[model samples]
Target: MPTIYLSPSLQPFNKYLTTGDEQYWMNLIADDMVPLLEQNGITVKRNTPGTTLGQAIRESNAGNYDLHLALHSNAGPVNLAGKLRGPDVYYYPYSSAGKRAAEIIADNLRKIYPDPDLVSTVATTKLAEITKTSAPAVLVEIAYHDNPQDEAWIRNNIPLIAQNLAMSVCEYLGQNCAL
Candidate 1:
């Protein structure tokens, strides 16, 4: 079975515009992803809510996982707060596997997001989750938490988001995913 290290945001400070914090919503999505992945014969190792971001990275690196998927919500820059919208799936610029996974995730997200063009894949070296892990990694910023419309979309479609993400993982792993 392909194994994945699922790291939801550990940052409790990133609050959604109307509802829960980033950690809360991401964990709920992870909750939904677990069973979907397991049913498809994938092994998932998740980070604990109490763990720090550094610890999450350390633990994920210690495991022999095929992929490291980090779930998070975007927050715009101070000047652009509440103005930005969309999902940005990020991968380490140097990793081909990471880029492939990010692309697959971005493509799948386009199907559910309001504007298909808004969903994109980004290459970055700044995020620890993507840079420090041994396995191929992709960090998905589901949507802009500061934007009410985006926030509401995420809140209303948690299960759909989870399903889409799980399917993306299956695609990357070359596993057949139903639903």
Candidate 2:
């Protein structure tokens, strides 16, 4: 079975504009993905709540994982608050495998995100999760939590989001999964 390190956001302080925090929503999606991941013949290893990103990176690097998937919701900058929507799947600029994984995730995410045109795969040299792990990594900013419409969309579609994410992972792992 292909093993994946599933790191959901640990930032409970990044509250959504509506009623929840990034940590809460990200973990809910991660929690839901676990069973589906296992059923699809993938081994899932995840970071615990309250752990730091450094700790999660260390744990993932110590493991023999095929991929490292970090789940998070986005927030717009101060001046741009509530103006952005859609997912941004990020990967290290120099890693081909990471870029491919990120592209696959972004494409799959477009199937569910409100505007397919808004879903993008971003390449960056920063972001510890994308640079420090042993496995190919993709940190997906699932949606803009600071936007009311996006927050409402996320709150109402947890199951669909989870299933879509799981399908994305399965596809990345070369496993067949129907949405």
Candidate 3:
């Protein structure tokens, strides 16, 4: 069974700022995506201390996992707070596998996000999440938490969001396990 390392945000401020609270949505994502992968014959190793960004990364590299997917919500600069909106996928600029995974996720998000410009960004060298991973990795900022509309969508569409992402992973890996 191929293992997927699921990383959701553990940011302290997210609860205070978002409508539905952090764990509610994060768990919805993790739970929904996990079964979809399992149905497609992929085994998911959900990271515990589950919402911690750094701990998730550490676990993804701790063994022979096939993929590392970091999930998060976006927040803009203080001045642009509650203004920026959209789903943005991210990849390590130099890794081909990372780019492929990112494209798969971006393609899926493009279908669901109202933003026509939904796409992937190449992470800079200083970004620890993308830089330190040993496996193919992409961090998805699913929506802008700071934007009211985006936050509302996030609050309301947790299942759809997870489904879109799960389908992308199944599509990318071509997992067909009937087990």
Model 2 regions lying over 4 Å from their true place: none
User: lDDT of each prediction vs. the true structure?
Assistant: 0.94, 0.92, 0.75
TM-score of 3: 0.88
| Model 1 CA deviation exceeding 4 Å by range | none
> After aligning candidate 3 to the native by TM-score, how far in Å is the CA of 42 from where it should be?
0.7
- lDDT of the structure predicted as candidate 2: 0.92
- Assess every candidate by TM-score: 0.98, 0.97, 0.88
> Mind sharing the TM-score for model 1?
0.98
- By descending lDDT, how would the candidates be arranged? 1, 2, 3
Candidate 3 lDDT at 9 equals 62
lDDT (Cα, 0-100) at 42 in candidate 2: 91
Model 3 lDDT per residue over 1-179, tens place: 67777776666457525455555566678877888788787878766534466777777788787778877788888899888888777888898888898888988888888784855565555656778888888888888877878888887788898888888887767764332
